[model samples]
Target: MNFHRTEVRHRAVARLRAGAKNADVAREFDIPLGTISYWRHMDRAKRGECPGAHDPKCPRCDGRELDSAAYSYLLALYLGDGHIIQYSAHRVPSLMITCDDAWPGLMNACETAMRKVFPDNSVCRVRKTGCHNVKVYSKHLWCMFPQHGEGKKHERSLVLEPWQQQIVDAHPWQFIRGLIHSDGCRITNWTTRRVGGERKRYEYPRYFFTNTSTDIIQLCTDTLDRVGVEWKPARQKSRKAENISVARKASVALMDQHIGPKY
Candidate 1:
């Protein structure tokens, strides 16, 4: 489970709690009905309808306390609409973010793609279940912007690609662990060249980086800006005796820019 999945679960739970019917919610949100049911029951338990906490049980043996049938009931409730429940592909995380605006369209695309492949609704349903074992990938991703740029823009829903997973997997702790390392110094004022060729000065501490490429530094800057943190690049020390190429520096700079500055 990653941040995006966590967000999906939370949204699902919230929607269910808001009196949305499981099927309607599932259909509307492109989530399986069983997920809706599970969250709904969990909501009830949270409100104290069930004295015992929900727990994982053995898949085998129905007559016992935590039997398959009992678990199935919970599973069915969570999924709603009698859809068979499957284990989540990964662990669920505590925090997640996703593009809400594009998800519905993506779901429709998935429905169409799946229908094309399976033709029969029953076959599609079966594939939906079995597809759990197969990796279903996202189609595309984009950012959402306010009309005329009046309001804050949010990241548009982007489909995750299988290769994106590899890129993500390449950096194990990029999300959890801070990438840029730097020292902090308090500043009463800052100065930089303005686009209009005038020197502009503002009040803030300047952030510096060492042995970091320009791209990564920019990424650090953008990330900080998003979070309302002020940042600016400082001069880099020359190690030119070793004859570093401009292209190498440029590439490093790009990657670093995306990575952004950090402490």
Candidate 2:
């Protein structure tokens, strides 16, 4: 401990007391982590600080004003294709959403929504073989995303909390948009038809949302019904999964106005 200057120790302790992580303080001050932890413990003891201090950044924990629209959309994204990972070395959990490499706009939208949901945290993008994972770290992820649990999401119950349901109900379109950006697609279907005794080609655009969880599919269909969008359960030809289709011209138009194709 004496190897480090007294001023460095003071600075490290100050940062540690101000809610900075021991690892961050150690790296910033070029001090061993064990020494930093000891110094932090001493500083906390001397100041009579509580050991179990709750973070005020959490809306559920601290009564902060949650961004309902952003949270609703993010909730849909999480339920659709996102996941929260708790690392062994990290006390906080990370929220991650996989975005297709082809849709740069969709990736930007996901990152923006995450930032809006957690303005104080840093968001990062990790590159994969053909996609990018946008992630943000937070201590109260389970509080925010109560739907997170062990095993795949399709296997567990995904009942939304009362507050979360309120947000979704208030911003149904945004929720639908996020879900579409995650696991839904807008495609054009075409077929040949006889018109006026001649062969003619006809094409139509529609939206399809596919998920392995029946609960999530039901949520999507419920929202669609709430918004007066006609939808039907679609059958998969090559896979066993639940899918919802918005094929009616009016419904497609409504979806286009509110939640268009992923970027």
**Best TM-score among the predictions, by candidate number:** 2
Overall local distance difference test of candidate 2: 0.86
Candidate 1 wrongly placed segments (more than 4 Å): 1-4, 51-86, 89-263
Give candidate 2 regions above 4 Å deviation.
Answer: 1-56
Error of 1 at 41 (Å): 1.6
Model 1: per-residue Cα lDDT at residue 115: 32
**What are the per-residue Cα lDDT tens digits for candidate 2 across 140-187?**
898999889899988989888988888989999999998898889999
Cα-based lDDT for every prediction: 0.34, 0.86
Question: Each prediction's Cα RMSD?
Answer: 20.6, 7.1
Query: Candidate 1, residues 1-263: lDDT per residue as tens digits?
Result: 21227778788778777777899888887877766787778678668776665432211222222222222122211111111222354322111111123234422333333233222222121223212111122111011100112121122222323432333244322321222211121223445767587777744423233322333334334444443344434444665211111123343344345433331
TM-score of each: 0.21, 0.81
Question: Where does the lowest 10-residue lDDT sum fall in candidate 2?
Answer: 47-56
TM-score of 2: 0.81
